[model samples]
Target: MRSSLLRVGVVAGASALVLATMPASLVSASPVTDPPAVDCQSVLAAPTLDAAFDAAAEAADVPSDLLRAVSYMQSRWEGHDGRVSNDGGYGMFNLKSTTTAVPDGAGKGSTDRSPRRTASQLERAAELTGIPASTVRSDDRANVCAAAALTASYAPDLNASTQPQRWTAAIARFGSADTFERQVLTTLREGRARTTSGGETVTLDGDPTVDVAPPSASDPETDCPPDLGCEWIPAGYEKLVPSDPDSTGNYGNHDKADRTGPGGPKLKYIVIHDTETAYDPTIGLVTDPGYLAWNYTIRSSDGHIANHLDPKDVGWHAGNWYVNAHSIGIEHEGWAGSAGWFTEAMYEQSAKLVRHLAHEHDIPLDRAHIIGHDQVPGVTSGATRNVHWDPGPYWDWEHYFDLVQAPIGQSAKNTSSVKAGDVVEVRGGYADNVNTITGCQQASPGSGDCVPGQGTNFVLAYQSPSLEAPLANDPGWKPNGAAGTTYASDISARIQSGHKLVVAEVRDEWLGVWWAGSLVWVHNPATRPVVLRTTAKTVTTTSTTAAPIFGRAYPEPEAYAPYEIPVQSIAPLEYTLGAGQTYAVSDDDVVTDYYYAQSFDGSIPDDRTDVKGELRYYQLWYAHKQVFVKADDVTLLDPGKRAVVPTRLPKITGEAKVGSALTVSNGRWSREVTDFRYTWLVGGRPVAGATGYTFTPRPADAGERVVAVVSVDDPALHPMLAPSLPTAKIQR
Candidate 1:
């Protein structure tokens, strides 16, 4: 008999706060000049002020003419400082009023406060200019300066090369709703005013020099050398032919100007981009002449690749002149900073396109050269502070690299074999359960459980110059930083020093390494390994004892009851036997229903029955036999020891209603049963449990319930009373 009882306990909630802070690094400045206009009114009237706009633009390190055009577009040079719009925008630059507040003397506040009037605008500005709202609003000069700074954030090289087109994009970020003509005119007017006013002009390497080239006049044809691995094929060009095509290959009313330079160099890099729009919308926009154009548009569904621009001429993508001149841009249909997994088809097609392009161009498929918009270095040291982060963290670089079959080898020089005491560099990405990650989750540890399908949100662990080792922990973690409320440990696991590992290991999984004096891990996917090749060799061997035959013995004698012959055997093993296999054993008798068996590992003979028992409880009539076997040198033919089936206890048949008690007897055992687990089973599953031994008929419990219960003599010593093979009948 055994005792039966249930216990429950109450649970409590706990919380903790940890203080952490890191010094902010200074951002680099741009080399372009500022516009000449001082006030909104003056900027609206100016025209043909390229020189004046150039000077101001130079100060901002943005193209002088482009700045003038954008100023015309936004506020039309008609903005007033005291005036306010419905959206709470103010100032000549229409700076949003919603501003981010600095950490007050009081600890953490209930909400973040900023000068920017609208949350969205402030966020957009912050993203573009890389300037904190707290800094932007502190001074009027900074407000307009930051606005210009944000404009310069676009690819500088692109701006320099495609001044009109790239600058239009940079301004569009600030005034997307405005008409193109209005935007361009406003920027030009503002550019003229700023230049005349002698506003600051940006200089490169501290040198005040300007190289102004005339607008382009002719559209150049694409030319690929025979040896470059690219073939001129017209198969997909038909799909791109616009329905209402004009000379510029555009159908709409937007002005098209050809700025293709004279013979220089063929485009080499194929830059990938996302439209930051829905699929259908992106496709329409890319194909529309009125909107900006790229060389190709990749569909998300079938990964259907479409070509719209010639690879030879520059496409208005990447927002940088330098990049635009040498790169063929491919726009992927998607939204920026949105949560959505790219389809397998899209990845496959994109990989194919990239591989073909890589073969065509002499560019190496490596991170330093083949990078995301975020990785593009600033045009000058000063411009590094302001750059856009497109193709954000969600992109899976590792899987993409694998598709190209780039050589990813464990660096032979890596200290992977280093001992525990030795140091190594372990690196990898920090993705939750499903393996996506981002820069960092600036939250409390454990407060933010990793969301499934979302990429990691943390930075990579780099070796610290002072320490000659990777940081003890990922620097990306700080509760109050851009990531917000996420703890580093909660977001990423640790990798140690002296650990040798490849770069690909860090992107989609939890990666770490033993480095310096400890193991450290970081969430960075951009870092991947270089490509390589390998080969294999062969060796010889031998065998023994005809693979010793296997068998199974059951009804293990040790579990047998008194007077019970528990010997049963199964012949020559049919299946390949290995470790960890298990099987059940039962008696041959169907009516008697009493048997016992034990599970064993390794090989066992079909004739052998291992048994042990006390004389009072059980005994075997066979002559005493002893077998000697080494602890580890034995194999079990039987997958496992057999399972012992208990003998059926006698049933006390009767009928009772609702709460009546019942009793049954077996040999010398007699016990009263109350609330007995009464169930009936027709096939194999359970029916309903009834309180009485005999249940009344009910529609729901009509099916047989296989009732089972364990009886107990003492409250503490509870022994199970095996029920008779489930009796079937109505509850009545």
Candidate 2:
């Protein structure tokens, strides 16, 4: 959000205001000389935008660094052709004249106003340089030249000793915003650099005479919570060489491009992730020029934040490129199934950061926009079944939303039972909601290593309302009566919280939801239900008995050209939604297509290879998973009010450090507990007489894993035993 008050170059008529302000002593007495007549075609031939800008500046007698800084200020050096900003700006220069005129005001109705003229910036540039507006809009070289010409018009006294501050007003005019001028000056004085995805190196050294001004009106301070020691460690974008000599691999995990151009992708979501690794290691990974990156990472220990990539750039973290293109990724430091819960400090800071981003970007404050890595859609049919599920079930979506000022339970008071045509939210409370998920250490190679501290924010689906019944069937994974396991590899048997479900059948405590084309039941008793009743539009099959489901929402046959592969556009999955089943439809109208580009190939005009289909699909909230259905075969129902699941998880604390005592804290719970018992284990074997509040490890425990198990007993609730995540090999 750069302020627009520092405009010093923009003026009425064909010339800029700075031209008249030039000191006579600073002006060259010799006749003004133009470098050379290089057309847009020649400029486009350069290897990188840096080269093009350098050449343009040389020809136009403008400082190459100034031109580069101006372009960076305008579009981050992304070449956006023919796309218009919200304020009618276009191209890399973001010239306002090419598109509709948008008022330049800091806020809605203020006395201050920018100079409004009869001509647009594009028209003025064309008028001053005799270059066609179409050429300027269509060619990268032409755009650079136009930008260079503008900079040349504001040329001030020049020498090796010239201070960058002297050109601040001119730079501000180039960006048409004072805030932008500060950004340019800072970049110039501090040095601007980045390695393009195409493997080109670009850098501009800070001017020796230029010093960045102190924080002021144009360069405001970042408003962050005072307690958190926030730091801005820029991610390395330097071109890297492969460690293996024979490999041609390189890394600088982001693309420099605008997302809203005609061929450019539109951003729509913000994804949350958990770094399976710890805080320091995670920071190291992100800073490695050769590794992937996320927009932000929140330290679990102290709720510290490190912002690496700019929100405008695309980072390579999400497995799906479309999601990567459309979303900002935030990584939290914690294990998905560890006994130690996410700290409150981290949650507060994360909520504040997300709230600011959502408000600034106009992102919807709902599950649909603010999502986990598990919810990102697969790019193709084959990719859907294996999409990652991270920032896993343990993440407390309920608490997170509340901190963001959008609690999921805000509508829970208005509804009660899970009914047909109504939406239900799964509410497997984190921490204390002791859920039984089989297949942990049992799946390991030799001796399995598993612990009770393994927690998830999901509830297993059952075939009947009673817990005695077997789990529901998954047509894709366990079609032959295989039970769903808690192993990370198995996603069939559970329904995570925060997901919306369409109620198909409600029998007392049991509620059936349409899951992966089948009716799956989950225990939702009136006394301790895992789900909350909420008003939502439900979609049921229109066919006599069932409707086929699909891994993707591709277009109809007629949408594709005859030369292309036909079946690739519309392949139905092996599963189907039964006629009697009802499921919540998050969005009934969605285009069926894929943003097929896996990575940026460094095309100048952004050649995004896309696969668009003509068919329409409805997004269904199936149990804990998200799937697609044919919009044609489903009938949509409208319901009025809604309810949400409650959150309740007991907190556990203490590190599993070797030779050190371990402790567990019972978290805030909805039910009252009468007593607590503790048991310590060494290498998964229960220790004799080891039951205590704390136990110091001995030499015998060396090289063996250690853990603490706490059992809580309550009068009205079932007895629950929660284990701590095992420690590394115990030290002597």
Candidate 3:
């Protein structure tokens, strides 16, 4: 944690007297009051959390009652330990500070704004207690002790008082927020009972009539931006159910889900979106039960906000339910093509709201965690080609990130310099960016204005540094190797701001990146900053030819259902990275699975469920689009050295029957690679152009048996090959 105010004063005798009279929620070393089920001696002698708090309070000369009350208000007795809260707080006391470690959670690839500092309360606690930050993060007792010490240090003027009301101001001072004191006093007076993470019972008795005189602030509601017009318009779910017995539920807006459990899918992302409609209509659509629901909606006119759902529940706004389940979707009033629809007031207010929510949820303040709706991935391989692109090219990501206090260019020293294997980030200035688009139309039919607008979240990639050069090729969009276009919907060639990609080649003022399995160039201006550089690990192939790229990351074959027809082939892409080309790997070992929920209507069985697979793939920074490759395909290596080689081999899949397609799977291994290649062998002889994920037995092989030769490679290692055992003889 950064340096904080060390404002401890000389401890007066009144402090000790006040501390001696207060009743602690946990068992203490002293026998001043009736202890709970646990005895004071046993608690202090053992390494229980209660003893740590008691000792810390004693050492700091703080009242244990006050310490317990403050902690309860912050985390409700649940210590997240190493895992941080949405607001960046950690452990039982919700300590927050900054360090350079990347946040641990889902979508690791999307959060490549690495080499940035992060602060947590846990670090602050470590600083005060003189305990190692690692120990404080892992040990519950140490965490509690540190929190107690910090709280004690904050209230040097507090004296021993039996009544809780007297310590209200000091308690408030401990949290450093306007609402902290009232909330703590409220919990202290009313009392609280909770089962700690350790399964121990702790309780604080309530005092209904206790008067808590706290120093009030002018703006008491601290969670919201004071300048915005925010309202609470509830959206009812009961009306969504059908009246007729045979009819399915009409609810399509949100899910009445259970609380996210400890091992349950974690809440990792906060999606930003645009309504593409008027503010009132968007609100009406959100509240209409038949339409989808997002957590909050910000109007463009006055920056007015309407919160429709609880953050804990799932919203149906993002096309992907897996993301919807693990995210808080916030919609802004605007059209994708029109710059006038996104107002400065709305942007400021949204940033404030986002900052507040990110803090409250302990979400990391980075582009990966704070993503636009356009960034959300499709559930299946086929769906990737079509997803919402609203809050599009005009969202002003650079300015928004600055408002969130995690600007991209501030983290690294040589942010402007680029080199081969360096991770290049598109940091195109939102306001100053002047790329021309051929087509600009209003998102809504009646929204008006088809004229091209001025705003940007992307930079056009070209074949060369000059503007006359053709746009980069997108294999997924144009497989024949056609040049990319300036079409508004043509996201294939443009690099959106905040996305990190590996540099494949670099010239004087132009740098090439691996995009959609081909080298794409970003024109670097000498005067104005268009790209930033950072360090990242990448996966490359040792093959002499281009390597394949995939759309989805799926688990190995044995892990998936045998009868399940491959929804969309996880085959190697036709467009491949040139041999020796290195690209950033988003995540080397990404789980392969599909979220297969189609509707909220109960009449349709298995409507809201996930079809999971055990397969794994490596997510790569190959293109503006999210792409993946099988874990067995390439080697995982750092910038300077090669990683250890895998000892595992590949296995053949699918029935060996004639006319049936067979595939190969990478067997279990410690580490994962990408760009898997395959070859079909007929009686140990190679077949031409049979290099896809699947292969069919040819008619000419009347008696010859079939087998599959699977090859995997990366820049660090030579290609690793495994041939499946020969199948039963082919029957003519």
Candidate 4:
């Protein structure tokens, strides 16, 4: 996991109206009298992405490091074929109103639909670079050139040849927030590199000695990481019914509580969400009484964080109240359906903030504790399908976790060892694991196409082990027994990366996992191994009949009788746990309780109280969402302790290429043991009659990482079966 760096900005300008839409400080520098300096032809003809930035910088007379760092922070130097951010900015440079002013939301309860609109910086970029906006939008080179020209025009204080650190105000002029500027310069100081979507490696060498003034700020009453430089724009917290002087049932935006303070609910999870709208308008809507609220809003362009509801309060963001009651919600400025809308700057900043929150609240840095809003289950059978699936398939959870200092599979200790009934994490590598990702809105039609892998966060499970079988089904996602679709929202067949489940049956490379109360098969090829062996605690149902699954772990009826409130039913969801089926545990012996908080005014009896029940529920990582099973009807199994331990693992060596001989150092155990075995794998499936000490790759194995499961016999130890780390991808 990458260390959560300090809260980790281009102002398109040389425009007028006195920096109307852009932040006043970020881009308020007087425009320079520079000529049309962008050498569009040179930028286009550059041999590499690194050379493209260098060419654009040389043409505009700006530091190449500045251009590269700003680009890195914005799009991770990715063009993505020139996609626009949710805030309507474009390209690797984020050359637009990246620092578009976020509404302060002071008069939060106001029902204002219209947010102040300003002239787009894209127009200013066009004017400064003397290029058509269409060309700037589609061509990566043109976008970089325009960014250089526009940013150079903003820095009238800095000539064509200014020190990298001296460009802070100019970077700030690109966007107003000091955090935005500092982050850009921080990228320069620390440097960064990334492989573009078009498959070109770009690097900006870091000079840790590069110095700049510390960021300035005015963050009052804000609960945020110091590096983030967040602004407190509190979501409305007033009575919705203004006519009723002391209305108990009316409230706007969020509920007030003493969470994360002296006395409050145990903060367990952090739910990630994406705003369907742009950043500024999201603030406008969240402040409105009718619209729901979340804790923070992260901007796509600059990574500026806007703190709304305090950690001490509850935001009505997640549809399930139980989840909201125990979780903190963070919203990013992007649409779930829009591919490449989430920026690297936003991911870095969000990671820092999340790392801070997780550390502060003592929450575990795992998928169970850090979840997407898409994983939030509905409160009942009817409501399951209605839950929002934001921060969708393209969220890059593996990268996000890497930034969060968890790095998904870094938690694996006994990974090279496993047996039946053990738990495993779905881990198809992001850059290579091509997935069939569809969208409810038809936003991504690239499903089932494997040319340039569109990496996703889940693995599709099939009703049978073969590729010809239909995808597995989910009762809550679809009740008609229809198979799962490729829709981003329909997570029926997708076993999200890092999700842990019990192994039901293993037939060669196909693993039959207990998913949604059924045994579904997931292909775990030895090559490009999709699942990581993990020693996680799992639980099985003790009930003779199928155990009922609940979305919420609410208090029993008797627990709420004393208060003037109706009981929150512990409704069983359509999905259930079969008697023999087991699932990985999120938490054991979770308190079965409910919070009674439905009043702005303290008119109701026992308001703002947590109702505790004698009954406890075990939280399980079941299917796409978590489910609560009664602890009394569940038996917690210590799978981790029972796993077969490997003292000295077998090894493999030789050329890992097509038709090249790859040798495995196996078959060295005592000959007395007759149960010992070895197997060679291609694309994770076993090669027929190829269980020898050495194997040769075929033409079909090219570009695929072939592997060998070297099982050694030990008469003293238990049966052990595991695969070696995948060998290098086969070469031609």
- Which regions of candidate 3 fall more than 4 Å away from where they truly are? 1-230, 234-241, 244-250, 378-385, 411-416, 442-455, 479-481, 541-579, 587-614, 639-732
Candidate number that wins on lDDT, 2 or 4: 4
lDDT of 4 by residue, 1-732 (tens): 000110112344333432343333223134533323343556767898889888888777778889888888777887656555655667777666433443332123335545564345666666555566666776788788878776665564454567876776567645444676777888888888788757889998998888856765538777786646888988987777777676457678788777776556667889999887778898998788777888999987777889888787889998998899888999998777665557777898899999999999888898987999988888988788888877877778888999998987786532323346667887765655667755535543222222234567778899888988999998888888899987666788988788887776677778877888777888876655677777677776554356889989898798887888778888888888765567888877575667778778655787777787888888888889877988777677776454221223434444432344444332343222323345666777777987644455454545565665544343222212222221222222
Q: Candidate 4: list runs displaced more than 4 Å.
A: 1-36, 97-132, 156-160, 261-263, 411-419, 439-453, 641-732
Return the TM-score for candidate 2, rounded to 2 decimals. 0.51
Candidate with more favorable, higher lDDT: 3 or 4: 4
Indicate whether candidate 2 or candidate 3 has the larger lDDT.
2
* lDDT per residue (tens digit) for residues 428-505 in model 1: 332331333332223212112233355432234433222234334311222122222122222212221111222212
Please list the C-alpha lDDT of all candidates, in the order they appear: 0.34, 0.58, 0.57, 0.71
Q: How high is each candidate's TM-score? A: 0.29, 0.51, 0.52, 0.77
Estimate candidate 2's alpha-carbon lDDT, on a 0 to 1 scale.
0.58
lDDT winner, 1 or 2: 2
Looking at model 4, residue 687 earns an lDDT score of: 77
Q: Write the per-residue lDDT of candidate 2 for residues 1-732, one digit (tens) a residue.
A: 000111233233412222334333322243323211222333445677778877776655557787776665554454434443322345666665643333453222346566444466676555444456666665566688777665554443332234556666556554423335555676677676765323345678777566655433211122234333346766766556545232223437676545545543455667988887667888899898778888888865335678887666678898865567767899987654432345444676689778877877667787767888877655544465566666765577876887799876565742346564457777666544656544432332221233454446777887656788777666566656566665754667677766777665567777766676555678776667777766567776564446766645655656555423333445555466664456677666554554433223443221343456667788777634455787778777666533211122344343433333333323323333334455677777768887754566443455777666655433222212111111122222
The true-versus-predicted C-alpha distance at residue 363 of model 1, in Å, is 2.3
- lDDT, residue 31, candidate 4: 57
Task: Return the top candidate by TM-score.
Answer: 4
- Tally clashing residue pairs in candidate 4: 7
